[model samples]
Target: MKIIAGLGNPGKEYEHTRHNMGFDVIDELARRWHVTLWKEDMKAEIGQTLVNGEKVLLVKPLTYMNNSGEAVGAIARYYKVDLDDIYIICDDLDLPPGKTRIRKKGASGGHNGIKSLIAHLGSENFNRFRIGVGHPQDGHTVVEHVLSRPYGEDIQKIEDAKIHTADSIESALKDGVDHAMNVFNPKRKG
Candidate 1:
């Protein structure tokens, strides 16, 4: 994979939201790569770095979560990157907080960012790393919960997941998606 797009909305208001888990992972990756991802082109924040000596583009879409495809598709086209060489990191509500999953390719499972990606890019073949943020609680709507900040213990869990997500991305770069999946995909608690 030559491109890694972390899914999230732009703006400080969305920084700590559960929906921004993808951005958190991207920030962690940027720190690891020693690159700040400050570039303001392609409708996203982009930076170039090497993972395991493999050149990779790290992207944080500024198109907001629902329209993330605009930035990602633009980057892919600009770089002439193959669709198969793109990967995404995103939040997943189906799993428990802190858990993560990796997939070679799949449906969006109702993730608007991913759905937009499939529509814009015309493919679901790109790899994805899903960070589990858990569903809303306390009668909060899904939108309310995802946009709200996590509290207490959930904070640490999400933070840990970011580190692990970076590690998983590195593994995918060095090895392959299957290897990353085996190494990083957490077992469910059910």
Candidate 2:
């Protein structure tokens, strides 16, 4: 069994915000997999499906962004899923907008959602799919930037990123994390 969790705040107002990239990707995956029903459990909206003969749970935490760990940790424990079988999707303010990076294990990079997950899960060994939203600019505060929806070309960029992220997740499921990382993660210029 594999648990794929997307972190974001829960509310109609939070939809399409930069910080809700994770939820957007989850929706994309749900669409691709034909998952139409979501049950509320473990403080999350869960859609269960079979991907390549693997039982996959697509999760959108309902605990909001900062307290996401509480729901994710409870689900992981109840499901008895190994840390390696858990995957996290979230926004990254470091990379350029629409870019993505995958990490096997690491620090949260100051992301509150990731920090909460680490605190609740008692480890940072899970896989992460980070969709870049970029940092604030033009005197915009981080909170304001993350909460606001994208505009103009950025709208297309983020839409493309969501598809790219869903493809990457499929690759990780079909192949292995190492292989998926090689295929999806951009080659860094030394």
Candidate lDDT (C-alpha), each:
0.88, 0.93
Error of 2 at 115 (Å): 0.4
lDDT of 2 by residue, 1-190 (tens): 9999998999999999999999999999999999999999999999999999999999999999999999999999999999999999999999888999899999989999999999999999999999988888889999999999988778888888889889999999999888889999989898
For model 1, what is the alpha-carbon lDDT of residue 173?
85
Q: Can you write out model 1's per-residue Cα lDDT over 84-127, one digit (the tens) per residue?
A: 68989999999789888888788989999999999888899889
Q: Pick the candidate with the highest TM-score.
A: 2
RMSD of each: 1.7, 0.8
Model 2 stretches astray by more than 4 angstroms:
none
Sequence-dependent TM-score of model 2: 0.98
Find the 10 residues in a row with the least total lDDT in model 1: 181-190
Itemize residue pairs with steric clashes in candidate 2: none
